[model samples]
Target: MRSISEIGEHHLIRRIRERAGDPPSWVTIGIGDDAAVVEPARGELDVITTDCQIEDVHFSRAWMSMREIGAKALAVNISDLAAMAAAPRAATLSLALPPALLVDDFDAMIDGFLDLSRLAKVPLVGGNISRSPGPIVIDVTLIGSARRRRILTRSGGAAGHLLFVTGSLGAAAARIERFEDTNTQGSYERSEGSYERPVFLLNLAREVAANRLASACMDLSDGLADGVSQMATASGTGAVVLSSKVPVDPTATLEHALRGGEDYELLFAVPPRRRRGFEKIAGRSTTVTCVGEMTKAPDLLLDEGPLGGGFAHF
Candidate 1:
């Protein structure tokens, strides 16, 4: 395979731009321009979020393919937008790469990133690329939209709001554990299914936001325990998370479900009066469960003990 140094940066950029296909009509200017120019949402608020995926810190090259890494870099940013019931509009990717990287591998990474972007209908707008002295780095910035007054915020919960989480947790965390265990012995296996492509909760979150079903909301990228505590702290209320109500993955332990981050599910709060309305929207495909409730006091308790920290990057 030809190395990145052989193809040169400008050529790689041109190839990526061509491979990105066409942008939506809303995107007035896409990849070739100095910066992306897009039409504003007619009746909604623009939501923007950025996330980074660094080699080793986020994923080891020994454990995952370049393509999977690229897909994951975008997915995490999309998850942030989905947490607030936002519809993805456009995305920009900045990559820091070593010149020794293979051109085919770079193409594979772009393919993976664009595939998910196409699936989400978020066109790649514009971004920068630079050479890295060490590991590869991928940074994604996603722009999304949500209707005014209908966006979900972490601080919207009240004392009587019922807490709910979408989908089961701990699968990703369990997979990470496996990666760590095997990597210690100088070998690693890619987990079945795209652990890199996490479930996007935009549809469910949009429905809940549109219907005013939830009072507070956030994505569980950092485990259920941290999610609950965050929402409670942001909303200035206490929280009570029932251990029995948490939907743990079949292959994962309860500890993994609670503290193993990267679940990428939605955690939201709905008032007791609107519980039925929320339930009507949640159906079977969504798998939402009432795991807790917001309280008047400021204490955050999971079952009977204090809710601890999770996945801190200190």
Candidate 2:
């Protein structure tokens, strides 16, 4: 019931450590330090990604609990790791809390972090918290690892590589669209699972990397159009996306599939010769669709013509 201002920074941190429990064996140092320290086992490279979510800008307390917000924060960061085929290991959080925020909400938010950290096998090692003059802001830095040979990047693609994406697109955008049109995104009491949950293609990405099934890779955060354009620019190749082949949610329009953001699906380029092999390895466990092919023309085209772009923050 108490506000964060009442307990002060020291006590609030003490409570956080208490909630975090004992550090895992790999952690050489944890909270209470100027910085965390860790020693990874030999033969693995570290993969790190960070993200920031602000109240109202990224989410609203009226729609989700502070805890759900916490989980979503980690999910987005993990999505970046998924793009690199990284196995999540540890995380650090930076929180800027307003004076009027309740202590209970802080605890709930940490609870969300704990839930995801466990699911992703990423432990909370260290972080910082400070007073904010305005809305709640959470910045999470997640560290993951993969063997050097298994790391995937966006710049490896080439002409004749087929572009593949995991799962359906536009659901998150559709969810937000529903929220806006209906005036109630979802029951304020329960967060919408589609937007709250992020799909991390850890297994699939590893398979693609290990087998050399993909030539280039990145997460489809912005829509398919943007994802293809990005991969094209990074690999110095053009992409020809089939307008009819892009997968979309039942509720979303084709435009939503093309321009929606925050899908978190993996957008990858595979050689035509490896496409069948990738599909065989991908199996029926999840949807992996080939929506386009890399081209030598150096242009992003849809069905042999120019394609529109997704949401732009600028």
Candidate 3:
């Protein structure tokens, strides 16, 4: 199989552009230009988010396929936009390919990338790809838009606010633990299969924002405790998460549920009286569980205990 070097930058970019297919109607100019040109709707606030996946640190090639990595990179960043209740617009990718990588792998990555963009109705406007002597790196920048009042943030929470999280937790952590223990990726249908990609709570977030159901919101990227702590501190309040109320994946531990990051589910706060309204809005389309409550004190207590350190690079 040929390497990326064999195809050259121009040809490689051309192939990727072709794979992305035509740009959406809202995009004026896409790949092959100096920068992507997007036409956002009037009065829509632009929401931008970036996330990266690096070899050894964020992932290992031996544990997952190239396409899965690509999907994961895109999904994580998009989930950030969802936390803000933003509508996805376009995305840009910056990839550093190791010399040992095959051209086919790069192509597969683009396939995964395009698949996500299509599903989310977002366009891949532009990106830069380079050769690197070090590990493979993928940095994704996702752009989204939302109305002024629709933008959600962590600072809006206050004492007495009810805390809720979308979907289950700890599965992603369990998957990583199992992978580290066995050095095996395992099947996608398994309990930990959800770890492979993030579930962007876009619709649920929109409903929360549109109805003003949530006072604060964020995706659980750095784990439940860290994310909840961040919201509490940002809002000038404290939080207490009930251990029993936390929805844990059957295969994962409570410790994993507390500190395990990258679940990509939304952790949000609603006013005391708005719980029923928020639940009504979310309906049966998604699972929203009340896990905690905001407190007057300024500390993060996980069931009356201290919060653990979440994922950190340093």
Candidate 4:
């Protein structure tokens, strides 16, 4: 058996892909991308998703506050829904907390979830809590609804469709790198804030669904390259992402933009003719850029180069 480190990231991904099998019909999109999309029924589309955050695995209690953890747990799942071009309506949370956690601490965490829920206009419908002998674990599941024929699926992208991404990438990844560097100071802490408070692009999802402007859509949760590759694979197409056209934080490196996770931004495919309309709808606050174009082949190329990878979980 090959060790994960020895196999490297791409090889591990290939191995996983071989075992995962084809996506289901309702799953217009599946495991390869930033988020999966499932069509619940005809005329009405419901997006279903879940994400888990474990202490030390996904975050560190030493660096992250209870509030941040709570908010992130919810935001990330909703971000998945947004990727499907759906509007989140309800959520359920399951928490495993250490015995040492005080009741007040738990309350603060709930408060954080509630705060973001209110902002997103999604409510917490139900949940479960329990004591854990191990590290803290948070699992969140969200359900979002979309109008008939409006939900975007990764499989919809085709050759000639233009690829676009919303907001800057790599800020969160850069922040995490800074936090790991002992030589860093207060600035590093500030950078980490981006990771803690990710903006969920619900409004963008609504616009895409309403206008049917996007040929395909998914959020940038795992990193731009990985997300785009997923779309290509599902749609039975290929893509060429120009590195220069990708929007990255001024302070972040190109590598970070390509592989960073937790950015919670949207990556979509649109018809060339609709490019201007999407740009106008995205507006000034959110940076939208045409990073690539879909191709007939199944390969995912970056700047006409080999595949640019993104974050992965084994």
For model 1, residues 1-314, the per-residue Cα lDDT tens digits are 79998988799999898899888888899897789899988888899999999998887777777777788898898889878889988899999999999998899889979888888888999998899999999999999898888889999999989999887889888888977877654334445544423434777788888889899899888898899899999999999999888899998987898888776788899999999989888653667889989999889998888988777776
Q: Model 2: per-residue lDDT, tens digit, 1-314?
A: 89989989898888888888887888999988999998785689988899998998777886677777888788889888888988888899999999888999888988987787777777788889999999999999988899988888999999999889887888778877777776774335543553324434776788778998888788877888888998889999988988789888787877888888677688888889998988888655778898989889888899967987878877
- RMSD, one per candidate, in order: 2.0, 2.1, 2.1, 12.1
Off by over 4 Å in 3: 185-200
lDDT of model number 3: 0.84
Error of 1 at 302 (Å): 1.4
lDDT pick, better of 1 and 4: 1
Say which prediction, candidate 2 or candidate 4, comes out ahead on lDDT. Answer: 2
Clashing pairs in 4: none
**Per-residue lDDT of model 4, residues 10-112, tens digit only:** 4433443443345345556544455555555456766789999898778766566777777788888878888887777666777777766654456556676
lDDT of 3 by residue, 270-306 (tens): 9989999999886557678899999998878878678
Better of 2 and 3 by TM-score: 3
TM-score of 2: 0.93
Highest lDDT among the candidates is held by which one? 1
How well does each candidate superpose onto the true structure, as a TM-score? 0.94, 0.93, 0.95, 0.81
> Against the unseen true structure, what C-alpha lDDT does each candidate score?
0.85, 0.83, 0.84, 0.74
Ten-residue region with minimum lDDT total, candidate 4: 187-196
Error of 4 at 132 (Å): 1.5
